[model samples]
Target: MIDLSSARLSRRGFLILGTVSASALILPPFLTAEATAANRYQPFSSRLSLTINGRQRQLDVDTRTTLLDTLRENLGLTGTKKGCDHGQCGACTVIVDDQRINSCLTLAVMHEGASITTIEGLGTPDALHPLQAAFIKHDGYQCGYCTPGQICSAVAVMKEIKAGVPSHASSSLIDAPTFEPREIRERISGNICRCGAYPNIIDAITEVAEASA
Candidate 1:
């Protein structure tokens, strides 16, 4: 003999309330799992063993780090400038396994067992490498931000020429390329100096090339 009218809800209201209650009961675990996953902090790092500057070094770095960042941040090798990190400016150039590459564009993990040579590796303040000396002798740089990459690239360019690698500016495609000004310019074109020091750079590179020859 209870009042059924007071206890009864509209069919739509009943359905909506039941559904909401069911959702509330079922959603906590899912929401909690998602929140836990979001809050989880797992450091992602890798062990890298590489020869840097003629010294064998081991480092534990985050997998997402780039070679340039590792060199600049972890190893304190800031001589390699990071300009136009898109790899277009070639300011982060470094020699890896005898090949010059834009360090900014490469991951440190990829070169785990490779030999890396940065600007600091090429020479010291008192004992300068030939190219380092040549760059200074010819005033090859103005701002000097791009000088490190230029020097590294010039070293590789000389090696490439000596290895008989032909460039587009080479006079004869079948024959070995000559180390002329045009060839040097074309070879090291990837390394740009915004200060319009092309002539001086060319002069420095030519001096080094001739000396190496």
Candidate 2:
């Protein structure tokens, strides 16, 4: 039994004001502990070198960063669009070691020593790549957001077909598929043109295929 008349806080008032009041006034260190832990999880500080766009580049980036994120956020190479973070859209496609892959699906750390070519490396104002010129001539794109991926995919498709990679339209079991519109469309079907430019896109692909052959 204690005296309550001269107490700083009344018994009833203290009971009404629970531990929440005290917690509101004072926070524990754990509030920011997770952020501190994340900061501590730094990537290897060693410099990484890779050839990009016919030029060698050295960069230091977080190990967890994806190639698409590194290109767009770190290097300011925004031509590789991010239509979908997942690999379904092919908007983030890039040529890695002469192969087209979804940049968004690959970690930058994985391509530390690989050669990478984005749409920026493909064409320039003076001489656009054949595929790029064809796309322009055929009006293959409307919004043009997916143009980079489309071109990269088209380039890789030609190389693959030349290498005898069979498509769904391949007629013979032993012989390589002919460079036909159906073959090109089937091979590049992974790349989705949201603008519904399939006809013009196919036209562009056919033009390049004919020129290549």
Candidate 3:
């Protein structure tokens, strides 16, 4: 290669080279069409269609959003509490396809086309579910924060017993789980009541179970 010092250089060629170098330094690589296409940004979001509380609903949510947030923030169904988002506490519990689950543990997009029911769907002020009424009679709504999850879980517990699903407290795995205090307590152990009102909660669930029976 000829040395630039020894080579004859036209004024226009040097000016053009200097201008191209400056443009490369000033402009971002992504500003180019090829760069933009190669580095396109894709949002982490998904559309979900769900039958919530007997109503058909559809919404778009971040793929990372939990079902608890979708219910409370997106759908305005705030009755499903968001305590201990790590899924240890059952405060974020809800019924999906007649089965109870911790809403905080699942992603909203994962339940597309699934039916869900929060505490608000159970009953209104005028018409209380048997469990809700029983809770009131038994004073089980101690602090009231964990009441939603407790009631939801209790509802599922009754269903599990009727469905003949065995639990750890059951006397035999082959037989249906008994609808007794020990079985009820075991089924609902995931729910925590900070108010330390376990006895009242158990009594309320027992009352509902007996009445339904």
Model 1 score (lDDT)? 0.92
| Cα shift from native, residue 208, model 3 (Å) | 0.8
Q: Tell me which of candidates 2 and 3 scores higher on lDDT.
A: 3
Model 1 misplaced regions, further than 4 Å: 1-41, 168-175
Residue-level lDDT of model 3, residues 1-213, one tens digit each, is 869997676899889989999999878764786787988887787878999999999899999899999999999999999999998989998999989999999999999999998999999999999999999999997679999999988988899888887676645433457768777888899999988889999999988897787
Query: Model 2: how far is 154 from its true place, Å?
Result: 0.3
Whole-model alpha-carbon lDDT for candidate 3: 0.89
Residue pairs with backbone atoms closer than 3 Å in model 1 (clashes):
none
Question: lDDT per residue, candidate 2, 93-112, as tens digits?
Answer: 99999899999998888887
Tell me the lDDT of model 2 at 56: 89
Model 2 lowest lDDT segment of ten: 169-178
Q: How well does model 2 score by local distance difference test?
A: 0.87
Task: Extract clashing residue pairs from model 2.
Answer: none
- Model 3's number of clashes is 0
Q: lDDT at 41 for candidate 2?
A: 59
